[model samples]
Every structure is written in structure tokens, then in C-alpha cells.
Target: MNPVAIRDSYDVAIIGAGPAGLAAATLCAKGGLSTVLFDEQASVGGQIFRAIEETPVTDKRVLGASYWRGMDLTRAFRSSGAQYVPEATVWSLTPEREIGVSLHGGSVLTAARRVVICTGALERPFPIPGWTLPGVMSAGAAQILLKSAGLLPAGRTVLAGCGPLLWLIAWQYLNAGAQLSAILDTTPAGNRARALPHLLPFLFSGYFRDGMKLLRAVKREAPVIADITSLRAIGDDRVTHVEYRRGNGAAQRLAVDNLFLHQGVAPNVNLPMAVGIKHRWSDEQLCWVPVLDAYGNASIDGIAIAGDGAGIAGAEAAEWRGRLAAMAAARALGRSVPDPEETHVRDELARCLRGRPFLDALYRPARIFRQPSGDTVVCRCEETTASQIIDAIALGCPGPNQMKVFLRCGMGPCQGRLCGLTVTELIAEHRGLSPQEVGYYRLRPPVKPITVGELAALPKTDAALYAVTRM
Candidate 1:
């Protein structure tokens, strides 16, 4: 995990140290390929298993046995012969397999015969009134704080929005003795009715027991306000109160210092899309997913995407997809790989994904939550509001790229990671088109913000060279 000793070239370069990236690296290394695994985190566990190796939470039961499962994966990744470089911020991947990365205040250019991007998932954009408030943060953020630093909300905390992660965090906070004010569930009642038919399929699938157990645990500990509406955080300098109306009830306000929001996650597509990979809108997940083959191969020949970055299929599926992608990459690189084991893994992956359609239908966020109305801030980085986006659309802005030109929705410090989905959905809704028809922002390097000093510090030997090929 040394940044200084990293080579400038490899047979395969995997971007990210999440479950998928780790699994892919392990397989490639086992095949005797010169592989390098890069990640921005100091450790290999992705968000799903963050801080598993070095968490202060001694009792693994506090976080559940599923959370502890990542330890086994990380331990295997460490023993793999692939060169693991932690704290490496990879900004771009060229079609020709050049990777631009920054680490330790310096830049490096690396090349590979095959590049696997497993950047994982980001919390789906959940824009609402007062979402930009100081105390307002994502539920995933709260979990990361808990995992990395054993930090909990100081005062009364309110969990808002929907998804299993919300329930998991609520249970974790309860276990950690944090004072949780309430749980505001935004999942519409109709979602459950629509998802009823798929329930039987899920019962026999992989996630049924665990999913039911998580729900029961949260329901036992927290007071859940279902079918919530008019959710708005109220405060001056910070979040002091959270207001919401349940079902047809009048607006109710609760004194809360922390508001943790969750509405599920979307694939982290900035890296793959930057390389001109074709993507399709997923109706089930209601987000953009890269158009990848069975083994996670992108439209481009030399690059492959795995994990939640390709699609949201959870950690176990990501590991399988990663191994499959590595096998594909190894074959492409003229290495012999086992076909039977790959077939078995693919079957297991399909089984893991059997319940996803049900989960997606059952947990789809409300329309208002997905695409907010009025003056709600849609783009946090630029402080762009939904009203501004509408104004742009009215002015003949056909897509998100033009909205970016007219309103700067995706041009900020965090790039488009924070607001891209909301912007896309907003424009699509206004234009009477699907999100894919409206199209997403055409990303460019450097994907992660980099300083000129870092660019100057790059080794002078490796120069930029990429052959342009249309896919």
C-alpha cells in the first residue's frame, strides 16, 4: 500500500479498492499478471464495509455479521500479489489504458493492457428544502463517521428518506446510544402494493432473511413516520428543527440538531462516462447504468467496469462481477483462465440479483423527492435551484450539458457527483423525455480536482498519448 513504490505500468490497473476492485485484483494477480490496485481511501473496504479492519467498534454484532464479512475479503486482497496503492486519487482513464492519478501531492501516469474501474456507488441525489443546511448530511456520511472515527450525532438526530441503509444506520445509532429523534420514511405506500407480486421470489432469494431481520430490528427500536411529506429542515446557523407532514396530516416539526438523509444510491458513473462509455437508463433502479456485457466489459474494448459503478447489486454481487471481469480481462490479455468456475460465479451472481427488482420497486423514492419542485436547491456545489433549472429548460436548454452551460449545475468543486442525477432527472421531467434522452454531462479530466502543483510534480518521462476510436 505504498504510493512511492507504485510502478508506472502494469498488465492490469484496477481503479478503486472496494470489494469489486479487490476481487478483480486478486484474480488478476493470481493469474501472474502485473496488476496494480488504486483507491482514494486509506483502506480497501468500500463504503459498504468501510473501516472494517480498523474500527473501534469491538463488538462486531453491534454492526451486524454482514458488516464483518468484508474483513475476509480485505484480508484476501492484502495477500494477493497485486501492488496495492492506497490514497491514490485516480482522475482519468483513457481508452488507450492510460491512467492519470494523484497521490501525496504528486501526480503519476500509469498504463495497463486492461483497466478495471470499480469506483462503486454514490448516494442518489435527494434534493429538498434546507438540504444545503450545515447540519444536513447523508445517512451514508453518518455511517462513515461512525465507522472511521466512532463519532455519533451530538444531539437529537432525525433519520429521513427511505432504503435499507437508513434502517441499518438507525439500528447502529441506537446500538451506539445516540439520541435519535425519529425516522421519517418517505417511501410511498403504493410502492409496497406494486412490489407485492415479487415478494415470493425474494423469499427464496439471498437477501430475504437478512432484509426482514434489518426491518424488524429498526421497527423495534425507532418510531417510524411512514409516507412522510413536506420535509424541510428549519434553522438559522444550523439545523435546529425538522418539519414533515405524515400521510394527510398537518405539518409537524421536531427539534433536531442532525438530519441524516438517505434515498438509496446510484452508480458512480463519472469515471466510466468520462471515457465515452455508452450507458442506458435502468427502469428498475431509475438511474443510468453503463451498457456493459455479462462480464462487466464496457462498450470500449480495453476497459471494464465492475461493482456498483456498473450497477447497484450490493457487495456480494460486486465481488462476483469483479472476479468475472478479471477473468475476462485476463483472457483478453492472452492468459488462460478457467471457464467452469467463471460459469459457476456468473450463476451465483444471477441468484444474488434475483431479488433486486423487488427491492427497487419497493424502495423507489417519491417523485417529489427525486425531482424537487419550487426553489429547492438541486445542485449543492453551485447552489443551483430547481427553479433555475426550469428557467434554463424554458430557455431552450435541451439537456443536462446545456443546463450546465446556462446554470453551472455540474461545474463545481465536487464535480457532478453531488448533483448530476438530480439535474438529469429535473431536465428530463421538464423536457417530457426519459433521462437517457436528455443525456448526462459529458465528463472530462481531471475528474477529481487537482492542483497545478500536482500536475507539475508528475514524472516528466510518461507523456500523454491515447488513440481515439469510436465505439
Candidate 2:
């Protein structure tokens, strides 16, 4: 994918091309703001709507009704007159609204009057023994292949972990006529009981009916093992078998060519955190999330976070959040958004989020899964094991930052994106403190790795020249 021509500045800059970013760009551009949208992917839609334009999944049933919704969003965004830059990385975003984007191996420095980060969410790390094995991957990864490339695993595959995504993936694979060996459901038996209080609202929401349909479809085609208290992938170089234990029962192993794991997703917070957005550990979601107002404005002025990056309210809510944030940005830029329009977006967003608490409760990952033990590898990038993290804590490491000093747990190239939550949870458990008290990694920019050549190749302005030479 070739890069689009970039301007020196824009009225609004969106850092993702998912539902939120797309919706925000459409609104901003339609409102007469000179808007620019940057997405690292070759296309938009983040994960949920990935490959909305390019996917080869001709049968809508394969990807489902929810996915086809992105077609309308893409159509709106393309016609809205916003500059859409595909294969672009907005790696460094400053609090003052400067954006450093890399395209075709070079960096472009641009600015915006107001910035909306819609980087969306990442699959919460599912670290287990042998997860680092070659054939093992995330369920999200598998779905990406099905969506983007119309590809599926060649042999028997096992889908493990708990979350709506797990079932969705299983159903997708089934609908696509792919082979499914089994599904290892690790949802604790008590989760349903815990989720019951929130049930009434969940049943009334739009998701309930659709979710039940997907659930029934998946269960009918796939063999499901429930209450899987433990899981492991077995192989020397690549996962050849999936071993799991149900309840307190003896372990069982199934030969499988692919092992896809998921425990839901958390906000993709690296860029926002690097930009100094205030964040807190979400107790319900079990991950770090940005602190934002109702309009998605963050702690810093001129910066707002929408979509799952604000919190995981799913894709429809993300689109609404994007509109809300765009409206806030437009207002901040001295543009007027009609009161009724703002109220409608706000109301839609509320309706979308009404069932979120229930979903969060029902799908909350178990503590044992969140905090691994012994030989389980916690940080895949650093090869930092759960035992290693535990030893650091036992040796008086107070938190993730200090543990980094002791074991280099979060300093790998991926920078704690994979291990940050795990390390925080491990430390919290050891110290008998909450994740909030334990805290997250102190992040910095450029959030994504950039080449020295890329930085030096940056169009050398007065400030750029000054920074390279003290004289």
C-alpha cells in the first residue's frame, strides 16, 4: 500500500483507522475540519472490522452481520474528504498535538489543532507454558488471517480461553468450513453466578440475541470442554498438542496443529500512555485504561481518546465515541456541533455501553490466568518467566519499574506491551495490593520503534537541525 500525500498540519489528526478513527475522521472532515487519519494497517477497521474493504470472505455469514457494518463506515469515511493514509505509523504524539508518522521508511512530522487517538484494543496477553511455541497464536491472530487473507489453519485447531471473541472465532472458523479440534473454555464456573446480577440488562441489550445465536452456532459445531482450570501447549519447537484440565479432573491432551488463545482484549494504551495521558487499572476489565471525560477528553488539553482505547465498549460504541470525541475536538477548535446531534451520539453511545458491565463481569478472566506461576513465560519478548518475576518480588522489588531494573522484564523491543499487565498483576498479588496501587510501566515515545535513518531522514526543520547540533 502506497502512502498518501501528507500536509504540514491539519485541523484534526486521528491515529487509528478503526471504527472510532474512521467515524471521527468522517465527522471532522464533514464539519469542514481539515482532518487526516493514519492507520498502521493496509486498511481500516482495527481488529473487529479488519479488512472491511479488502477481505475475500464473500459470504457475509462467515464473518457475521456485525462485520459487514464496517462497509458503511468505510464508505462514509472515503467520501467525507478526510485524508486517509494507509500503511502509516503515527509513532510519536506529543501533548502539544505534534505527530511523528512513518511512511515508506521515512518519518513525517505533522501537527493538528486537536488529536483523537483511536488505536483501539489489543488482545490481553494469554501467557502459558509453550505459548512461545511456533504453532501457537492468539485467537485474534487467527481471525485476522481469516478476515484479511481468507486463510485458515491447515489442520486440527484448538481454541482456548474465555471471552465472546473465543466463540466468535470458533463460529467463524466453523462457518468458513475450517477444521476445529475442540474448544477449551476456561471460564470459571462461578463467572455465570457472578454475572447473574447484571443479567437483566444484558438480556435486553442488542448483543444478547446475537451473542446467543453465535454461541449456539459454535457449540453445535465444536466440542467444548468447560471449566478448564488449567491449560498448556505441548511440544519442543511447535505446539503439537493442547493439554488442559477440567475442574479438578485429570489432565487431557488433544493432538492439534494450531493452538489459538484469547482472554478478551484491553485498550491499546501504549501511545496514549507515552503521550502522558493519565490512566488507571480498570478493576472490572483487568487492564490499564485511560482516564477520560464523557466526551473522551483526556488529562491533557487538545487530546482525546475514543473507542476501545478509552475503554472496551465494542465497535459500535467505539464509532459513537469517535463522533463524540470529534465533536469535542471541533468545539475546541471553535466549530459548533448542533446540540441535538451531540445528544443523539451520546445517547447511542450510552445504549451500546449499557450491557458492557454485564459482559465485563461474565467474561472477566480468572486471577490464576491473569497471574501465572512457576515456568509459565510472562514476557515473550524478554523470555521473562513468571518464576523470574516472582523471584524479583521476593527479593524486594516494589513494582514493575523496579522489577525492570532487576530482571529487564519490560524493556524488550515490544516494550511491556505483552508483559506490562502480567507483571503488574504478579506484583500486586505478591504484595497483597490492588493493581492500581502496584501501577503500570512508565511509557515514553517514540512508542513504536523507529530507525535512526528514519529519524535523521525527517524533513530537517529549524528545531530538527538545532536538536542534532548543540552549536
Q: Which candidate is the best by TM-score?
A: 2
lDDT of 2 by residue, 203-314 (tens): 8778999999899988888999899999999999888998889999998899989999999999988999999999998899998899999899999999999999998989
- Tens digits of per-residue lDDT, candidate 1, 1-471, equal 233776768999999888899889989988888999999999778888888888988777678877888888888888978898888999878889889888877788889999999999999988989998999999999999998888989988899999878988988888787777799999998999999988877787778998888888788888888989669988888989999998889999999989999999999988898898999999789889999998899999889999999999888899999999999989988895564397799888988888888888899989889888788998888999988888889989998888888988889988888888888888889889988788888898889999988776665543332222222
Among all windows of 10 consecutive residues in model 2, the one with the lowest summed lDDT is 334-343
Q: Which stretches of candidate 2 lie over 4 Å from their true place?
A: 1-3, 338-340, 460-468
Give all candidates' CA lDDT scores: 0.88, 0.91
Report the number of the highest-lDDT candidate. 2
- The parts of candidate 1 lying over 4 Å away from their true place are 1-3, 337-340, 459-471
Score residue 391 of candidate 1 by CA lDDT: 86
